[model samples]
Target chain A: MKEGKISLEEVKHIAKLARLRLSENEEELMTHQLNNILLYMEKLNELDTSNIEPMHHAVEQVNVMRDDKLKPSLSSEKALSNAPQQNGVFFVVPKVL
Target chain B: MTEEITQWSIIETRRRLAKKEINAIELVETYLKRINSLNPSLNAFITVCEELALKEARYYVDHPDKLVEKPLGGVPIAIKDCLCTEGIRTTCGSKILESFVPPYNATVVEKLLQAGAIIIGKTNMDEFAMGSSTEHSYFGPARNPWDTSRVPGGSSGGSAVAVAACLCPGAIGTDTGGSIRQPAAFCGIVGMKPTYGRVSRYGLIAFASSLDQAGPMARNVQDTALLLQVISGYDPKDTTSILKEVPPYCEEMKKPVRNLRLGIPKEYFAKGIDSSIEEAIRQALRVYENLGARIVDISLPHTEYGVAAYYIIAPAEASSNLARYDGVKYGFRAEIPSPDLIHMYLETRSRGFGSEVKRRIMLGTYALSSGYYDAYYHKASQVRNLIRKDFEEAFLTCDAIIAPVTPVAPFLIGEKLDDPLSMYLSDVYTLPASLAGIPGVSVPCGFSPEGLPIGMQILGNYFQEDLLLRLAYIFEQETGLSPKYPSI
Candidate 1:
C-alpha cells in the first residue's frame, strides 16, 4: 500500500459524506478499518502508471445518446398511490419548516 | 415428474412449453410450491406474487396457440426487490419504503414480461443495495441453501439463493460491486454481470448510478445466456443505455473456445487468496488446457486499488441517489415537528435509512461535500480510472481472465456481520470487473471441504459475453459438475 496515515477527523469527514451519524465507538472502529484499507491500497503507489492512460469503460462507446421523444408516463395519482401521505398531484409529508 | 420439471433449464422449459407437455400454469405453480417449501429456510423472497403470477400463467395457458415460443416464455424467475415492478411493492429491502409501490416497471422487468417470463416474487436484498451480505435487509438475511446457518452473499443474495434452491429457474440481480457474482458464488449458482450499459437501468433503483448493472442468475451458463438475451437491449429512456447492437446471447453459449488464451492475473493470486480456492482454479486451468486453451501469466498491478476506489465512488453516487428518499417525495415519510426544512430532511433521513446505508450516505456526502471533493472523491475516481486501465493492459495479451470469485467458501450467519471490512473482502476479486465495466461470470468449480460451494470467475472484454458464457459452458460440460442440487 502506497498511502500513509489517515486522521480520525478524516474518517469523520468521509462518514459525514456517507450520511452516517456515527457514535464515538463507530468513529473509533472506522478509523482503524479505513487505515488498514489504505495500507492495503498503498501497494498501488508502487505501480508505475505515469505512461498509461486511465481506462473508463471496457468498450469504446462514446455519447450513445437517444433522440429526445415524448412517451406515456404514469399519472401522478398512480405514482403516489403508495405514499404514506399525499397532497393532490404529489406525495405529502410533514412540513420542513 | 414435477420435481424433474423444476430442474429443467430455461431452454428445456421453453421446449416443454412449446410441445404442450406442461402449460404455463403448472410451471408457475411448481415453482410457487417449491418456493413455499424451501423459502422458509432460505429466506430468499420478501413478497410472493402468487396471484399475479398465476394470473399471468392463466393468460399463457388460455392463449397457447397465440404464444410465439419466445426465448423465455413461461419460465419462472425471481426478481431482486430493488427493481420496480408495476403494481407491486418495491421496498428495496428498506423499512423506509416498506409500503412503497411503483406505478412503473423497470426496463428489465418490462423486457421480461414482453418475453412472456413469469415473475415468481421479489427477493430479499441489502437495504438500498448497500451491504455485501443481505444482512442489512430489514426483512431478514437470505440463508445459504447448502447450510441453513450460513449466509448467501448479498445485495443480491435472495436472487442467487432462489436460483440455487430451485425456487426459481432463473432470476435477475443487480451488481454494483460484487452484489450479483459474490452471492452467486456463495450459493453455488451461475451469475453474470454484463458490461456496463449492456442492460438498461431505467427503473432499477439506483445504488451507484454509474456502477449499477442488472444481470442474470441461474443454474447454468445457458440459462443465464437466455435470460440475458431477453432482458438486454438499448432503451431510449436510459440515456446511458448503449445503442450498439447486442449479440444473440443464447447462440453465444453454443460457441466453443478452442485455442483460446486465458489470463490469470498475478495480483489476483496474491497472499490474500485462500489456498484451497487457488488449487481449485489451478485444476480448472488444467481442464481448460486439456480443452485446447493456453494459459498466460499476466499482471494487473493496479488491482489493489479497486476496493478503495469502489468504496469512494460508490458512496459518492449513493449519497446523491438516496437523497430522493427524503420525506418530501414518494418514499418513507416520518412525522417530526422540526423547525426548518433542513431539520425535516435530517429527521426523515435519520428515521428512514438503516445504519449501514446511513453510514455510506454520510461517507459519500462528505466525500462529495465542499473542500474535500478533490482530496477524496476526485482522487478516488482517478484511481478508478487506473484500475480500469489495468484490465485494458491485461486484455491486450489474453482473451479472458480466470480467477477465484471469493477467497473462502460460505461462512456461517453473523460471521462477518460485526466487521464491515471482512464482509467487503468477500468482493475483492469480483469488484474489478464492475469497476472496468467488463463482463464476468461465476461458475461452480468445486465445493469446499465442508461441502459448501466455491466458484471461479471468468471475465471477458467489454461486450464479449459470448466468450464469457462459452468458457463457463465448456467448463460446465468438461467438469460434469452440473446439476448438483441443495438437499432439504
Candidate 2:
C-alpha cells in the first residue's frame, strides 16, 4: 500500500482520525469504496501543473477589517438553545480531563 | 385565483398584490394547499412552516404600501434545508441536525424575508449538500414531479421539485459542485449558482467553503433574475463577499441579446455525452443564432480532470467544515458511548451521519492526512488553477459560455447509489465552472425521450449575472417551454 492510500487498516485509521467508528462490515465496504475513488482521483495526474501556483481561495481577498464597535450578540440562552444536552448556563458534554 | 397561483411569478404577484387583484394571504394559501396535497407523494419539503408563512402573509394584508420596495413581495418561496432559518427546524437533510433549530437565519434567508418573500418551507436535500442525488437525505429522497419513478438531481432536489410543481414561485439552493444546477436541470426549472462571494454565506451551513454558493431557482429566467437581485451584494459578515456594487439585474434583463458571443466548449460536447441531450443543446443554439447571437466553438482542454479535482477539493473542505458536529455542539449528540468524551464523539458521529457523509469524510481525511497532503490536496489545487485559466482564456473571446448542465438526464433513484464514482461523473459539465469561481445557470432546454427534463448550462464571468440572465431570458422567451406545471 502507498503511504497515503487506503487499505482496511488505513480506512479504520482515517475513520478514527475523523472521529467516526465504522462497523467491521462498514470498514471493509469503505475500504473498497475509497480505493475505487482514489483510483479515479488519479485522473488529475494527467495534467502537468509543474509551474502553476495552487489556488486556495476562490476570490482574491486582502485584509478585511471591520469597525470594532459594540454590537448586540446572541445571548447565552439563545446560543445554547439547540444543544442536545445543556444546563441553563452551559452546554453539557462528557468529561474531557 | 387558483388558476393564477399556478403560474404567478414574483413580478406578477407583486403587480397583482398592488392592484388588489389577489390578497397575499389567499395567494400564500393556494400554494400552501398545493404543497400539502402534492408533498405527500413528492416529499419535496423537510419542514413546512405553514403558521410562520401565514403570519408573514398577514403583514402584507394591512400594509400594502410595503410592496413597492419589496420586489418579491407577497411571493411564496421555499428554502433548501441547508440554509439556517431562525426558529425553524433546519435539518440540512442529516440526522446530525435532525432536531436542530437555528437561533439565527442565514443571510440569504434574511434578505428574502426583508424583500417581503414568505418562506413556505425548508426543502429537502442531500445530507449536508453532499450528493448528486437527493436520495442521500435522511428524511428520504424527494421524487421527481415529472416522473415519480426517476430521481430529482440533487443536493437541491427538493427546491427544484418545489418550484417545478408550483408549490412555490421560487426557491433558493446552494451549490458546491452542481447541487443547484443538476437538480434544476432534472426538474425543468431555472437554477443559478452565483460567482463565489457574490452572495453572503453568513449563516449557511458550510459544505465546501471555497466552492459553496447560494443561488436562485424559479420556473423562468425573469423570476430568477429578480430573486438574484435580492440576495446579491456585499456583506461584512462574510469576509470573502466582494465589495463591488450590484447591478440592476431586472433592468438589465430587459436589454437586447443581439451580437452576444456564446462559446460552445468542445469538451462539453465530447463523445461521452448523451446524444439526445447534445441534440437538445444544438437546437437551443439554433434558437440563439436566430435571435442574432453568434456561437463560437471553443475548447476547455482541462475539462476531463474537473470531477477528479473537485472530488479531491470538495471532500477535503467538507471534512474540515463538518468537524464542528461533535457531541459538544448545538446539533444532535448520541448517548450510546459514555466512558469518555472521545468515545462519545466517535459514537455520535458514526450514528449521526449517513453512509455518503462518512464516505466524504474518509476521502477528505485521506487526502489531507500526513504524507499525502502534497500528493492529493495540493496537486488538485494546482489542477484547479489550470481549470480556472481555461475559463479565463475562453472568456477573452466569448461573451458567455453556452453548454449542457448535465451530460445525461436525471437517472433512477437507486441506480448509482452503490457506485459513488458514477454519481460523481454525472457532474462533469457543471464542476469546472464551480471550480473556477465563475457564475453558471441551468435553464430548461429540452426533455429526454423518457420525458424527463434537460437543462442548458450558461456560464458567465465572475459577478456578471446580468449578462447570463439576459441570455437565459432571451432563450426562455424564444422557447416558451418553462412556467408550465408538470403533470403531478
Per DockQ, the best of the predicted structures is 2
Residue B33 C-alpha lDDT in model 2? 89
lDDT winner:
2
Off by over 4 Å in 2: A1-5, B1-3
Query: Candidate 2's interface RMSD, please?
Result: 1.0
What lDDT does the true structure give each of the candidates? 0.83, 0.91
* lDDT at position B443, candidate 2: 91
Per-residue lDDT tens digits for candidate 1, residues A43-72, read 455545555554434455677655677777
* Candidate 1 residue runs with Cα over 4 Å from true position: A1-69, B337-340
**Docking category for candidate 2?**
high
List model 1 lDDT by residue over B158-229, tens digit each.
Answer: 998888888888999999998999899889889999999999999999989888999999998888988898
| Ten-residue region with minimum lDDT total, candidate 1 chain A | A51-60
lDDT of model 1 at position B297? 98
